[model samples]
Target: MKYTEEHEWIREEDGLYVVGITEHASEQLGDVVFVELPEEGSEVVKDEDICVIESVKAASDILAPLDGEIVEVNSAIVDDPGKINEDPLGDAWFFKLKVTDLSPMDDYMDEAAYKKFIG
Candidate 1:
């Protein structure tokens, strides 16, 4: 898993990556009420805004952490935004990206670094 300073996380699986917010982000957002997901097969660039999450506290954008085609979206989250708070690292994953360049991941924080950064 890799983490972004923006509080996003990406986990690799079978050459694709599942993307979601970290638990700290979920908690900071208060209660999530809505989620807007990008289209499957849409091309996205690193750091581009791709999804929107609205919470009781404020609305936030979920940025594309890498350049890639969005291969899949977790509709379950759109239907139930609270899932992001309940399982941010698991079933609440927002999208799957087949990244064009993985080098950006090398610049992202590892678990230990991310913990220290959040601390």
Candidate 2:
């Protein structure tokens, strides 16, 4: 998994990139109540806000970690937002992107660095 400072995580899977908030982010937000996902086919730039996640405390933007075209969205989390807190890295994933630039990943952190960063 590659992690951005904004707390988004991206992992390559079957040639597509899966994206979601880190568990640390979900914990910080308390409990997720809503998620607004970007539409499929939208173009996004690295570090730009592509979606929004709302919790009881506040709403946070989910940024794009790499430039890409949104190819799929995880509607399950939109319907049951609390799934974000329950399984932040798995069932609660927000979207998948068809990557356009691999260069931006050079700025992301590995799991260990991300853990340390949050700590």
Candidate 3:
């Protein structure tokens, strides 16, 4: 799992990555109400906003962890945004990307580093 300073995580498996908000982000956001997802096949660059997660406090942009094309989105979150607050690291994943390059992952945070950052 790789993390962004913005509090998103990207877990790479094979050549694809599953992206979601970190637990800290969900906690900070208060209560999530809506999630806007990118369309499948849409191209995304590293650090680009690919989705929007609206919480009771404010809407936050979900950034892409690396350059890639969106391969799938979890529509369950769109219908029930509370899932993000309930299980941010499990059932609330926002999207998947087919990574275009593995090199950019070097810039991301590891689990330990991310935990330290949040702390």
Best model number under lDDT: 1
lDDT of 3 by residue, 54-84 (tens): 9998988888888889989999999999999
TM-score of 3: 0.95
Model 3, residue 53: what's the lDDT? 86
lDDT of 2 by residue, 1-119 (tens): 99988888999999999999888889999998989999999999987888988899998888888889999999999999999999999999999999999988888999999989988
Candidate 2 lDDT (Cα, 0 to 1): 0.92
The superposed Cα distance between candidate 1 and the true structure at residue 28, in angstroms, equals: 0.3
lDDT of 1: 0.95
Candidate number with the higher TM-score (2 or 3): 2
Q: What's the residue-level lDDT of 36 in candidate 3? A: 93
- The candidate with the higher TM-score, 1 or 3, is 1
Q: Please give, for residues 42-117, the per-residue lDDT of candidate 1 as tens digits.
A: 9999989999999998989989999999999999999999999999999999999999989999899999999999
Can you list the residue pairs that collide in candidate 1? Answer: none
Question: In angstroms, how far off is 72's CA in candidate 3?
Answer: 0.6
**How much is the lDDT of residue 31 in candidate 3?**
94
List the candidate numbers ranked by lDDT, top first: 1, 2, 3
